[model samples]
Target: MSNGPTKRAADWAETTGFARLDAEAFPDFLPGWVWLVGAGPGAPGLMSLLCYHAMQQCDVVVYDALVNPDILRWVKVGAELEYAGKRGGKPSPTQRDITLRLIELAQAGKRVLRLKGGDPFMFGRGGEECQNLAGAGVPFRIVPGITAGVGGLAYAGMPATHRDTNHSVIFLTGHDASGKMPANVNWPAVAKASPVIVMYMAVKHLGEIAAALIAGGRKADDPVTIVSNASMPHQQVASTTLEQAGAFVAAQEPPTPAIVVVGHASDWRSVLDWYAPALRENPIG
Candidate 1:
């Protein structure tokens, strides 16, 4: 029933090292249950082994827009692939419809995998989907994947937390349901909460966000780093300050699906940038 092509079991196993993994260590993908699995930030290689197990067992994969398409090559031979992706400013399936479809699929005794890019609980709406599943009495499990705020930043050589820089880090979203800056966020309090702040889905309102932070007692020249298309081949890293973030972003026009970090942690990127150099040295596969 798969609409997409699937690799031979032996070939895929050899390619992914699936054959060498201990099968008994992984739980069986049961029918009538849903697994909310994270596919990691952007790199297919970042996917967890358990996630790959689910990929091999699931009857259907309901994935997000941010999930790299290359990761889909792991799906089982007969499994179906469903695009339940939701992109900002683009035509997307309604949340209600997507949830309903999951319920419908599980009710039919299919092993369902709700695959998402980044950790599902980290602003990915995995919680809401689980709530709906619980209401419907659909058995479900959560498999946490690497969130972009942490994994993505690491790929850009920016640490979310460094003891010397700060004792705490805050992770927040840039927009609310209406697609504007989140009104409920206490910018002043957040400005003082931690020395490091990692924001997701913030590229659209980078200027306003930087302004609010600056107005809330954060230094205008505070270091900031934006990692776009993180962990992917075309990953981009942009460094700016709270004062010039708006203009810098406007002028440079960096790509979307970016993670914005505000604080001194970005300062370490000068020496920590390993991914870019690694890519450059081995440009050919």
Candidate 2:
């Protein structure tokens, strides 16, 4: 039951031909409230229905660099779409500016949608935006989407965890706020405990990070795979070892928006791999 001019499920179905859902089942996208939504890896099919439903109701969409362009096609025709993405090594909007823009939009009585790639909460700087919104006394909703570490890996035919390969998985970023190796990571301790390690945005210093993992007791030959542009049609994956990951990447020069997975779970890509089920999409092949 909704507070608006509610449309019957049958009427909605008769118009859109989707019989299972009613428009009123969802919370109304009220003006002056912001919704931070995760667009999920790169595949439009991977996006959550809630994210899609919310996008359809937004008055403005402020999206990130990683968000798949295909998903933008679903935004309501009249909605204003704005790009506020920040890509590494590229000139981009400051985070403060982005957050301030959101506040400004909300104050203007617009239903703003902040669409991010993958789960908004997972290293998406979503928490910061939400904090800013809270301080400004603006109401907002958080819509979780599949993270690339999980969903992107799956699309690349790699699992972050497997009973036989790993009992635990660790996800870490390559760079922190400074755009260098993270200052707080206890490399050895993390390397010792994590059987499957997924590294995000680590391409710039893959060599140094790989060396650290090896020095910390990880096997030099431990299988490591890099997945780039994951879940997208142009996705690429590269396989190397802890000792050679940096060199392999340097020689191959795989593109950015990549993640590095270190551990036995990546070995499964040899057998269970199915980036393109019909196409046999192995980057090495």
Candidate 3:
């Protein structure tokens, strides 16, 4: 008969206001539960519709370091904004404390929003927070956003997956809570298996990570791309090799908020860099 899939999608779009949303698509109603939303890498526009909705409706927002401040401006007036950021070498709230705060707020019958940077589940400690909420019997919903591994890499002209170089990609964090190279990571195995590696919050441990990868049989000359403030107007990209990344980054006085990507996919950045065009049109700075 008629195109059933197309018809269904159209109906869904109309029902959810997806087809009619304009620049300001804030929700008019609030759910009687908590929402854990990913704000994407850095660009406020990269935030999902559900995230925007939650911001508009939530009574309080508990956010992380990477969440763009501009996005928070969208929160309704009188909404409480609590900072729960965890920088590598800075004094910040503990993960347990943040989780407990969410539970407390949700229990108070407030529409709680736990806003994070990038995908909540991608090394964002969203799993632990969700587990805590579940244990406290607090109902919650998750809103996925673009992760830095993909969005940040895209800004630097690197793709996580390429048909020619890599069919799969591995995402990992460079350091653990102790601010050291993660001992739990099987570097040798990852070096041998993953053709593409994307790391978040790895700038501080670049030297150790590079050595580990080199020791794991990865080439010292393997391509690498370091992106800082990715997807934002102040974005900077530094291209080098595994052996030189540490020194190269140290030499440059680049701004903070960075991610590191190592693999053949980084080579594709030279030809496929489109973020410049996007940035020229919408300057975040």
Candidate 4:
């Protein structure tokens, strides 16, 4: 990795409130090296120090659709910010194309930052990006962030795992690359084993997925909550049972960009709810 900016370090660092961070400890984003970073679940406050520092130094940042645009304000001046964002049921850049762009930028001696929403490894296709980078012999670093499944749930006052609710939590995706229900999943097994179920991108197929879970032995009255626009100022939370979740969430305004949490732990949302008021009064600056 390169030793970072020479003359402008103090100016940018102090201005960004990043000068307090030790550069020696957190090296600058070097030219020709890509950093695959998670922007966390839609909240700038959830951004990690490493990811924030990388944003301050990167020359080109390729980001996903779910990443909050407000976070991009921190990127260094003159750096190219590319929207490589992919939204379900919408036209987006292909994975191969996105990876090739990263390679192209790095080869051109630009500090490439692949900024994704939530933890990149958690069904974010970050692993696929890393594989392509590795095969192309690109030097890169992975920076993890809070996933919507965990962090988003926290924002909605729903814990993924609680001693009374569950010991084992199941983290699964709602769809495959083709945007269909995942074929490999054994719904019955997941229904039987897991105490709490946290799903990503499940809103689209909530009806079918709910039926499968119900058929797999989950109770019809099981508490389920869908957290939409998670961790954002306009975030919304809707609750229903496993039997009615599909129809219940359909009534929600902005539905696709959501996280669905199932099992007993979801009940605590009413008691533990905190972000609702904060989002109303303060919002995130």
lDDT of 1 by residue, 71-177 (tens): 99879999999999888899999999999999999999999999999999999999999999999999999999999999888888887888888889999999998
- Tens digit of per-residue lDDT, candidate 3, span 1-285: 774566555656666544555544354444447899999998888898888878878899999999999889989898999999999889988888898899888888899999999999999999998998889998888889999889888777787898999998988898898888899999888888888988888888887899889999999999888889999987888788999987887887456678888888877876988876555467442
Ranking by lDDT: 1, 2, 4, 3
Clashes of 2: 0
- TM per candidate: 0.91, 0.91, 0.88, 0.90
**How does each model score on lDDT?**
0.89, 0.87, 0.85, 0.87
Top of the candidates by lDDT: 1
Location of the lowest summed lDDT over 10 successive residues in candidate 1: 276-285
| Greater-lDDT candidate between 1 and 4 | 1
C-alpha RMSD (angstroms) for model 3: 4.0
> How far off is residue 45 in model 4, in Å?
0.8
lDDT of 2 at 173: 92
Q: How close is candidate 2 to the true structure, as a TM-score?
A: 0.91
Summarize candidate 2's per-residue lDDT along 1-285 as a digit string, tens digits: 776654564476566544455445788899999999998888887788788888889999999999988789899999999999898888999999999999999999999999999999989999999999999999999999999999888977887788887888999999998788887899999889888999889998889898888888889998888889888778888888889988898899888898889987777777877766455343221
